[model samples]
Target: MNDIWLTTGETATLLGVSRQHVVDLCDRGELVCTKAGTHRRIRRSEVQRLFNPQLTREQEKSLWLHRALMGHLMLDPQKVLQMATENITRWKPKHRADGIAMRSLEQWEQVLSGGVDVVVDVLTGLDEVSSDLRQNSPFAGVLSDVERRQALRSFREHWDHEHTAA
Candidate 1:
């Protein structure tokens, strides 16, 4: 099943979208695929992601931290941007040989350049790209030490509550 590839129609059926919509996703680069003669073949895992946007526990924790950063950004957009720019510059060399991280870094650079609204969107977004961006976030130390600890504490408590209830 790991190597399985689905046609546009098959992918559409799994996602409950039209075949053309699947094609549109591929064309938009939201989904990656390879051409099989005249048709596109998408990976099963890719379709699964469309169905499940839920982040892992670590990613969830990171998102919680970024949410705190989001609030800080609103209060001091320029300072937050400066911090991100510095982090990006400092981290870029470390990820130079890593294609995915480099791309994520590039996107972060573009988002920072786009201004406060763009950065907010990425910080709060639950989309695949957003999740990926959060994983490679250059906004480290944007929140004060106390703020970071408080945010993580709250997240952990809530996460534990949810899992325990389940």
Candidate 2:
């Protein structure tokens, strides 16, 4: 199962590019592949590595946490809310600033318990909060953006690998 191999066409389709593009990538040594008689055969892992590269241990853990949180949000909102509240409480003290009140946990619980619409509102409100904080906390903003991108990239890689393997 882990030894899945894809032809150039299949690789191109998975990568959302042209077959010639995949060929070019292989030729340029950007994508690893082996020749199967006349055609090129690329290992699924190689293709995935080309798209996702590698992440540090902390980045990997953060991606796993993000995926688990998203799964919980979809399957068990109550559990997600509970976990989020606990996490907020644990991290609030570390992030406490002069004007920042530790009131978000209460508000988060309220919105999470309200319904889907309220959850959406909470997400929107969090975006605004992040923006406001970003202005004063440039390091936090950079770290957050990097974490978010890594989480999303890892999630997409897992999703694509799962479906493609299936």
Candidate 3:
């Protein structure tokens, strides 16, 4: 119970889902969590039930820690997730997804709001001029924990190289 409240990644691994899935669960009121800005904090009691709803006296002694945890940690789920996502991709750019023009900010917003299904990111002229825009959106698909980091690393390096050359 003490350990479950340690970190979200730990909890998500215990729950067998992505960090984002955990966040979504929290957002939708599906899972119990306390939020501090972007970071989410969860307790064992919040996550324990999902692992095993049915209780036993033995489990109650350990307070529902998976017996496997007493042994080695589970195998890396990243490989399976990577292989699965090597096909069904998400957050792909609009221009890449469709041969559409991304010539302006309005066009990007239009694509996002006009029911053209893709994760929409808007970079505006606002210098802290804010709106009701939430960073996470309904259109944003399930981006697993593993894939998200790989994609970020891959793209950031590419972008950096391109900028350096120019």
Q: Which has the greatest TM-score?
A: 1
User: Between the candidate structures 2 and 3, which one is better when assessed by lDDT?
Assistant: 2
Candidate 2 per-residue lDDT over residues 72-118, each given as its tens digit: 46676666566655665666677655435445544554555587555
Error of 1 at 90 (Å): 2.0
State the local distance difference test value for candidate 2.
0.59
Candidate 3 lDDT at 127 equals 13
Off by over 4 Å in 3: 1-4, 54-166
* Stretch of 10 with least lDDT, candidate 3: 123-132
The runs of at least 3 residues in candidate 2 whose Cα sits more than 4 Å from the true structure, single-residue gaps closed, are 1-3, 56-166
How many clashes (backbone atoms < 3 Å, residues ≥3 apart in a chain or on different chains) does model 1 have? 0
TM-score of each: 0.69, 0.34, 0.30
Comparing candidate 1 with candidate 3, which one achieves the higher lDDT? 1
Per-residue error at 165 for model 3, in Å? 74
What is the alpha-carbon lDDT of model 1 when measured against the actual structure? 0.87
Q: What lDDT does each candidate get?
A: 0.87, 0.59, 0.43
Could you give the C-alpha RMSD of every candidate to the true structure, in order shown?
Answer: 6.1, 14.5, 21.1
